[model samples]
Target: MKTYRIRKPKIVVIGGGTGLPVILKGLRSESADITAIVTVADDGGSSGTLRSSVNIAPPGDLRNVLVALSDMPQLYEDLFQYRFREEDEFLANHSVGNLIIAALSEMKGSTYDAIRLLSTFMHVEGNIYPASEEPLTLHALFEDGMTVSGESKIAKTRKKINHVYVTNTNNTDKPKAARKVIKAIEEADMIVLGPGSLYTSILPNLMVQEIGEAVSKTEAEVVYICNIMTQKGETEHFSDANHIQVLHQHLKTKFIDTVLVNTEKVPENYMDTKTYDEYLVQVIHDFKGLRDEGCRVISADFLELRNGGVFHDGEKVVEELFRLVFGAKY
Candidate 1:
């Protein structure tokens, strides 16, 4: 007999790239209404290249989120994820997911509608939307007065992001927030952020003014899932406190109430190696720093990676978050 559970609270996860998908996978089991707000500023690889040549929002992050929410039917998901390998060929290195999204966007007359249609086909459990409808180019103005254009270049340069703003500021067709998304935030038991690249994945959505504001006003207790490792160029030497500080700086609100940090220690052998050790992030000891920022920190053993590499155990992370929200560990 099938036992029906009470509908879980809505969850709005804002970010782009690989990290958002992982969180989606874990939370899907909880049956919360999920809404993913993806960054559209990519201009590298398949997504960026397509955005530049085709003049549409990059579909890479949106593709990843769609797949994560998709029911795994073995070949079904595999077929969607497969990328061509041969260089110089027409479809070289482009994800099948990206191609599918791009084609749907063209046919439907808008990227937003296309994703909605694709979600139906994939049978994704939750909703996913790009942060904006009009394509947004990520432009970074460094403190030294030099400006870096494009998400890829800005990500690689070893500079503190002085300021990030979108191009085509005149375009007013901001993607309507999924009605479910705003409702989810308002009704959510909790909201989770990060465990991904700060500037690339986390901050890009916050850079969108409306999205940032929505986060500020939501009644849900906002929980930041801090990244375990620092990106050398982007978040160099950033402690958990610094990460929260950056988000607070950008939003100018008391949005983040609690931070979930990984306190698990990686094996010494794993840390001493070069390639595997490259971006290893350590836990922040500056509890006082976090306290100053008006957020309480919860440290736990939340590290694990299914596809390999260091990542917060999404299922476990969600478990912790759910416990915090409901006031009892599940």
Candidate 2:
């Protein structure tokens, strides 16, 4: 007698910053074949320094995502995430993992190859692909017609972002997806966008022309994990629908099939502004607007407040995602 074995669901998560790893960590516990497509446009802090000095794709986001998906020991993860003290002249503020990735990129001749090799060393349970093989520069055109060139500097403009795009930092060539990025999207059973920054973290990845095109053409159910709070310089006063609108306008397609929104109220005066100053208020709901934009809304209490900061409860979000995937499969 022949027996049939069920295949694991393929989930491709696209985004960067701190939020992508949160979702990835939760998905690591699930029965899914995960692929994390991380943005390489970051130009801030340790990442910016490395990108400028080594001319490599920013490793901070990729490093975090790698740790999230890896089965490495807690001590090893801690060491990788450790940052040098500010007093240190040469090594100040650089993470150990970023340095390792930079060194590996130099050794392998490319960031793409470095991450693939590191994934094996780290025992990463899933695929981690940089949005582009080379470093990308995020350009944000603000409402005032002025444009900002770097991801870290965009928010400092304090002006409304009209739109965002990416460019290859190497030369005049167009930014393209790292190899197999489009293939991952094409084969995915589900594509998760983000609970990250709207313009800087998420849009940077989608702005890659080939990636944007593949996402628009994919048959997978594209789900966006909506932000729990509005970002001060990015999406202040923006409703949940506004976020989706920005994504759709960037891609030139209503590609998102579903959105998971956090309807639970964040308690007033509960945020620790000193630590999480970028986040403003709770993201306002616009179910009608979401529907108007052709998105199936899944509103729930996906909020997880920690140390006075609000974020998505990844496990709950992943559970909903699996339900959606299996629901369609059956």
Please tell me which predicted candidate would have the highest lDDT against the true structure.
2
* Positional deviation of residue 305's Cα in model 1 after best superposition, in angstroms: 4.8
| Candidate 2 residue pairs in clash (backbone atoms < 3 Å) | none
lDDT of 1 at 253: 71
Worst 10 residues of 2 by lDDT: 1-10
TM-score of each: 0.90, 0.98
Please tell me which predicted candidate would have the highest TM-score against the true structure. 2
lDDT of 1 by residue, 111-179 (tens): 889999999998998888887776776777777888887778886777777767665432645534433
Candidate 2 lDDT over 193-297, as tens digits, reads: 997998999999999999999999988899999998889789999999999999999998899999999999999999999999999888899999999999999
Model 1 gets an lDDT of: 0.76
- In terms of TM-score, how similar is model 1 to the real structure? 0.90
